[model samples]
Target chain A: SAVISQKPSRDICQRGTSLTIQCQVDSQVTMMFWYRQQPGQSLTLIATANQGSEATYESGFVIDKFPISRPNLTFSTLTVSNMSPEDSSIYLCSVVGTGPLAGYYNEQFFGPGTRLTVL
Target chain B: SQQGEEDPQALSIQEGENATMNCSYKTSINNLQWYRQNSGRGLVHLILIRSNEREKHSGRLRVTLDTSKKSSSLLITASRAADTASYFCATQNQGGSEKLVFGKGTKLTVNP
Candidate 1:
């Protein structure tokens, strides 16, 4: 199990503004992911942040809207650009530990989310 | 696109009773994992059941997987008020990079 923490647990921002959330992990992890959870809905993967590489955004999400920077193996930042009311939701960061196999037994550990409310 | 779908959007159960939730996925997976999220908190990993294994248990939680049917179920015995939370099932797609696709969760409310 990993101890993950996210900055700005809750924030209220005006429309058109941007909010950057930080995620820190206690230990080094192989893969880090970002997800969005709309109220009363399932989570949607936003992107996968790979250290020293560009983040891979999922369909319907782009780097322009959500820029991600993974400086090292234990830290990453996600900036929600040009916030809108529709963008208000909980953003969570998840990581998969280095397992015995390259891709086997991949269990995700999530950070305490950052709740952003756009007014 | 979502791969898993959980049954019973919501459930209310009395403390000391058992709570059960089911999940169905679209494709074969390496493993299926269950997660629990308390209100206003991050998701906590509960248990994981591999495709080759039929069942797995941890503490009071039990998970069973049926690869032939592409479905899984989670059972919580002796529920308590603290057990009130949202439960989700995630499937690890076979082959590709190990990315997990999650399903809409089951909101379980254990009333004391």
Candidate 2:
């Protein structure tokens, strides 16, 4: 398993502002993903951040709203641009551990998460 | 798109009892995994059952998968107050897609 950490554990931002959450892993990983969980709801995948490449977003999510950057294999960032009250939720980053087959049933390790409260 | 749906949105059980949660998915998958999440915390991976495997156990956790029916179940034995948290099931397709689609989740509250 990898030790993951996120910066700014919790923050309160005004509407229309932007917040960038950082995820750092102790060891290098092959894939990194971003997810959002609304109040009392299941997690929704926002995008997959790849080093030195563009992010792949899920349906109903766009790059303009959630811009992601993965400059290296061990670090990634997701910026919630132009925040709104609806954007208040828990943002998480997860990475797949280095296991046999490199893409097998390897478990995913998650960061502590960044809690954003848009007022 | 969401691939799995968990039954009994919420469950309340007394400590020392066993807790069971079921998950049903829409499409075929390579494996199904169970995860636990405490309030205001990140999810912790519990167990994973491959499509070819019918049952698997890890400590107090037991997971069973029925690929033919596209469903799975997670059983937590000797539940404790510490087990009061949300449980989710995720599916990974056989197509080698690293992405995992999760279900809504079952909020299990093990009362002390």
Candidate 3:
């Protein structure tokens, strides 16, 4: 399985401040996805990031509020802009592992996630 | 948005007992998967059952998908204390893409 890491394991920011969460994969992958888990809620897909293209955001999630960037196959960043208390949630990024021997061939390996708290 | 709901939002059982969690989704899926997440950690993929398949097992975990009902169930047998975690069911929407839609998950606590 690919080794995935996310920066700023956690952070506390005041309202209106923006925070960028970074996700890095040890190996290059074709698709990287970002998901958000609000308190006591299910995981929601924020967007899908493909290298060298604009991210495809899901319904109820806008580019202006949650922007994403994929500079290469091994890395991506998700930024939460104009944060509010409701924006506080655990943000996670995952990648499809390469090769059949990597974990479950069809499974996604996720980062530990970045916990954000907005006051 | 989430794909569907997981029943018995929370469950508590004794070790060595069998724990079952059911998931219901809204759309056709190419495949349905079960994942386990210990508190404060990332999710770990458990098993995946394709739409064509009815049941699949991996060690202590057994998953069944009923396409007709658009529902799935995950059974963990011989549960141990370490089996305590939140179990989520995710599905790849039938559009042929691999985007996964996850359910709220069932929180299971196996006591020793």
Residue-pair clashes per candidate, as listed? 0, 0, 0
For A25-112, candidate 1 gives per-residue lDDT tens digits of: 8788888999999988878899999899999999999999999999998899999999999999999999987642123567777898
Candidate 3 clashing pairs? none
How well does candidate 1 reproduce the true complex, by DockQ?
A: 0.70
TM-score of 3: 0.95
Give candidate 1 misplaced runs (Cα > 4 Å): A99-104
Q: Can you write out model 2's per-residue Cα lDDT over B1-112, one digit (the tens) per residue?
A: 7788998899999999999999999888878888999997898878878889999999999998888889999999999999999999998777887778999999999999
Candidate 1: true contacts recovered, fraction: 0.57
Whole-structure CA lDDT of model 3? 0.89
**Chain B TM-score for the candidates in order:** 0.97, 0.97, 0.98
lDDT of 1: 0.90
The alpha-carbon root-mean-square deviation between model 3 and the true structure, to one decimal in Å, is 1.5
- lDDT by residue (tens digit), candidate 3, A1-119: 45788998999999999999999988877679999998877789999997898999988999999889999988999999999999999999988756532544367667899999999
**Deviation of model 1 at B103, angstroms:** 0.6
Whole-model lDDT values for every prediction: 0.90, 0.89, 0.89
Query: Which CAPRI level is candidate 1?
Result: medium
Off by over 4 Å in 2: A99-104
Ranking by lDDT: 1, 2, 3
Please, what are the lDDT tens digits per residue for candidate 2 over residues A26-85? 888898999999999888899999899999999999999999999998899999999999
